[model samples]
Target chain A: MARLLLLACQATANTVENEQKSMQVAAVDTSKVSTDAFLKNRLEIVRVDKKELPDGLLKVQVTARNVRTGFWTQLASWFMGDNPYQIAYRFTWLDIDGMEVETAASTWIPKTVIPGDTVRLNAVSPNPRCKDFTLSIRENDAARG
Target chain B: MNTKIISLIGITSTALLLTACGPSVKRIDATGNEGLVTVDEVDFKDWQIAAEKGINSLLASGVLNRSDGRKSILMISTVKNSTMQHINTRILTDKIRQALLRSGKVLTTTAVGGNGPDDMASKQVRRLEEDDMFNQSTVQKRGTAIAPDMSFSGEIVQQTSSQGRMRESYFFFHMALTDLATGLAVWEDNVEIAKQGKKPLMGW
Candidate 1:
């Protein structure tokens, strides 16, 4: 009986160690965004597409996937840390001259994502001068407070 | 004496530890999502999300730019608050107005409002025309005030439901821009936010 109990203990420890390793791998995968390092290693940009509207306004859509820590890692996080990450993003419009089109309309829109899920966020330019846009995504660490 | 000293030291350490763990407050960014959230109530972040979606949709529709070589004048109309909570509708409209003005395609007229003139100063300054204490040349003349070409109005509605230990709340923000001349709706948009979580330990 004692031997069996010892085996069970060892199995639990191995599960925890494996979970930690997977979390590390997920972190490393998040640092791939070259344009903005802040979002790197946090979110993976899967696709981006833009189109011009009939009124000459620009619309941009971005598909981003959250880095997944394994099931065991998520279980561990539920007990001791933040699990099921939340994030906020906004789009900054740019004119044809590459200068930012200033508009107070843009706000940080919040979204919640479970591990391994992809979320699509889209935005439209406030005026016809907007020819391009850059999306900014950051971890929604506000709830922790 | 040694026992008493040890007891005193222990009490001091315990007191310090408790103080460290006690609740404290700190400032946070207003425009950012750094505020507390309640499961059954609409929070600031929720308002921001709705406003962002509504303004973006309105701008993208390009209805405000339909005016011929001039910025469309907008008048603030009644925004109905149909929610259980006593929420001020200005929280949402103010954000939209700021964004619309920044776009330079629309201008809000302070000379007219659903309640009254948004800027009473327009009328107040006109009264100065008869006062010798004030310069008549600086006073706004009658008929010089521009009429609003369009009116902005909206409604915010909320619904709540509970299943077992979980509670869900949904808020819908609806807005419309009406052309005063044609008496037709020029643009309309709606934004909905839904949140589900464990029931609050305290009051709703």
Candidate 2:
């Protein structure tokens, strides 16, 4: 009977350990474009294109490229087990008169930028507010806070 | 005659006592169903967590407050369920809508595009007097009806991968807030929830 109880205790401990390990989130590089000071040092916003949406509103597409391949590439390599990873871009919109729209309609999102991949983000003008736009890119930390 | 009657009563009492002491009495205690351990694919606590997470994220992101001069009126658009199970995505979205309204950031209208028609019967009833006044030429025109300033639309996708008894199920919730006039998505959020479990053997 004592041996049986000891065996059960061992099994319970093993199960607890496995459960803890399984619940752990695989580490992914959480450096956001707006937050990472180090990456910003090496990467530069190369070109941005502005176009009129079908409603005659303007959309700005900003592309950023890394000047040095070392740090950014190394960070991407660290995100091995992160699945369904997404990169979100926040767009602050201004009216034709250059006033912020101040609505929930300002945030646009993009996902999954692998290593050495050029990421594209779209920022649309909310109707009458599409007179001008500014795009901010941030790397999403996996639901930490 | 008195002795015979007493004996008869005693015999009946003994028989009744024996009947009460039978195996059926033990069967009543033997049939136990409480505290049974079982495994389910989606537990009630999971839904509770998912609902709270979805609503909190949507609210905290300030998606509902983005109104352009207009009072942020929202219409529930479409919630596509891309899961193997026939899960009701509306249950999740409704909780989010209610939370948004409670936050005073936005209000949802039934009339706009959703899974069904908006409940306008109450609005219609209230408008009848105004309609009558307009018909009698007492008023020049009907009051301007408030239209939804934005539309809420999104999808729920689920992926399940398992190795033997160990199973991992992932659910992704994606939502977008779009401006009606420009058809541009202003706010978008995605939430991923995953659960892991080992298969139950035999009784469990």
Candidate 3:
């Protein structure tokens, strides 16, 4: 019975492979993420550089340092020297109208930062109309995530 | 009494094992991060995460931005897969292609390529001129086809190593975009994915 069930699932997966799942994206509100709200990600914000590329696309670079540590995290990372400060970040690109700009690269990306280590999160606007962006960060949920 | 207790423990253990067999199967987000991971072999999640880097970097390269008030035409030259896995290269390029199309900076060519056109219909449709049943005026006029302005190519490679009880696998996705007129690589990017795990004392 287990073998029969597995084959049926395999067949369904093959049929669904060519189809895409629908997704919804919400716009980024400047009112919520106004001045200094980026610090809520638990990482210390160091610097932000923004400029218009030769192609007129907006390019932004965020330099941040890992500064937060808990008792368990320190014990696992400092004492045992096993874990590092791992986090995942996603960029929310926005148009001038404050609407979300959809792009394949907008998905969450994972990163690892050792204590006191500085990292740079760089992004180039996927579309010429992308004029603004907001970043969302959270602790790494799983190994691949 | 001792015999009865051992029998009781054996029956309880058997029931627990059967119940812990886990679900048969389920569906998940193909592009999401909920996919499984392993220290060996490239999985769906690996391909998605790896392709995401290529798309982001390519758009950031500024090579696709045309100054002539026209979208740059792109051709997929060769994406070599030197990995040990029996994988198709399109799994990586298709995502990049879809992203670039959405950006509106570049349009991929389908009329010509190194390995022949991806879609033969453009070339085949032109052959309609030979059929007298069709209107000659409606046939696409000669010299209306556009040539590619740039070529996109890359390679994916894998490396493996083992130390003590830990095993590691590293993959590098290297890509480049070349200007056909100048024959110079205008943009290049390399993305890496590393996986490592320690083996248990027993089991394959």
Candidate 4:
């Protein structure tokens, strides 16, 4: 009788564990990140070597630094993997006379920013017609994956 | 006379014994091994690291997105070998091409490269046949040129310095992706690898 009762208890415990796991899995949401959070992590455009790209392409480098530091909750960082950090940048183009070119090519690119590290992102404009430009940066949380 | 003979025998035996005991002891040159050796030349590991960095930079910069509709087509163009030795530049270029293709943002030439397209001659033959049939059937026959959106070109340069037995080498690899239409480079990267060695020794 005791053995049977123990088996029944084990079965109940297994069912509860599985139900809890399913709940956790169901709670996970693969949603798009927020724009404000994205902007906060982005790079601050310090300076551009040339403001205008004559040939529709501009050669410029953006300087960015990682300013976040703290004891990580996922604490195997010393051996398993590094703390995640990302540099997100976007490029806005313009015509020779200085007008925004709203095209599909304008999108954010995520760059790996090492922890407590500063990086420079260099770019050469590929669009021959793009003359003036604006560059923006945001922090990327996608690097954690 | 007897004493002289005995002396000669004794001297010869002693000389033989001494010669046998001192079997040509040559010193091992340990100046190179005296300390940790650094390689001054670009090695396999260096190439690996540089290639990785270059790919990362290219991906991060979103240079390939410059094509029409944020989609770009790439072709493996000229990769100049500026180094002393004859190296197949394809090894490095191929890796870059593969990575770019896998990134889902860029498309590379699928045509097999012989003097024509496709790795297999049979596939090229089939494609040609299909094109010919299509051309014959169409009222307005037009030839579609498979022009690359961007052409990749680069060079690898190497430098070496030696002092006595110690040696150092540095290799710089520069790469650029230029738009075929405008003759403008859309992406450019430089990777430097340096190594040092005391002397030439063959072991990993």
Tens-digit per-residue lDDT, B43-159, candidate 3: 877777777788878877777877788998988888898888887878787778778877888888878776689899888878999999899999887788899988888998999
Off by over 4 Å in 2: A1-145, B1-42, B66-70, B120-143
Alpha-carbon shift of residue A141 in model 1 (angstroms): 5.9
DockQ of 3: 0.37
The whole-model C-alpha lDDT of candidate 3 against the native structure comes to 0.72
lDDT of 1 at B5: 100
Alpha-carbon deviation at B142 in model 2, angstroms? 5.9
For candidate 4, the per-residue lDDT at B121 reads 44
Which pairs clash (backbone N, Cα, C closer than 3 Å) in model 2? A32-A139, A103-B66, A104-B66, A105-B186, A107-B186, B110-B118
TM-score of each: 0.74, 0.43, 0.77, 0.43
Error of 2 at A36 (Å): 38
Poorest lDDT segment (10 consecutive residues) of candidate 4 chain A: A11-20
lDDT of 2 by residue, B74-156 (tens): 88888888877767776666766665555455777875567665575635554566564455543323445567888888887
- Tens digit of per-residue lDDT, candidate 1, span A1-145: 7544432332110000011111212233222334333244336777776777776676777877766567776675454223566667777776666677777666678777666788888888887777656666765655421
Which candidate wins on DockQ? 1
Specify the CAPRI tier of model 2.
incorrect
lDDT per residue as tens, model 2, A30-130: 32234354335334555666766443445556776544345655564344222223344456655545456653222224345544456555444444343
Model 4 stretches with alpha carbons more than 4 Å out:
A1-145, B1-42, B67-70, B112-123, B126-145, B200-204
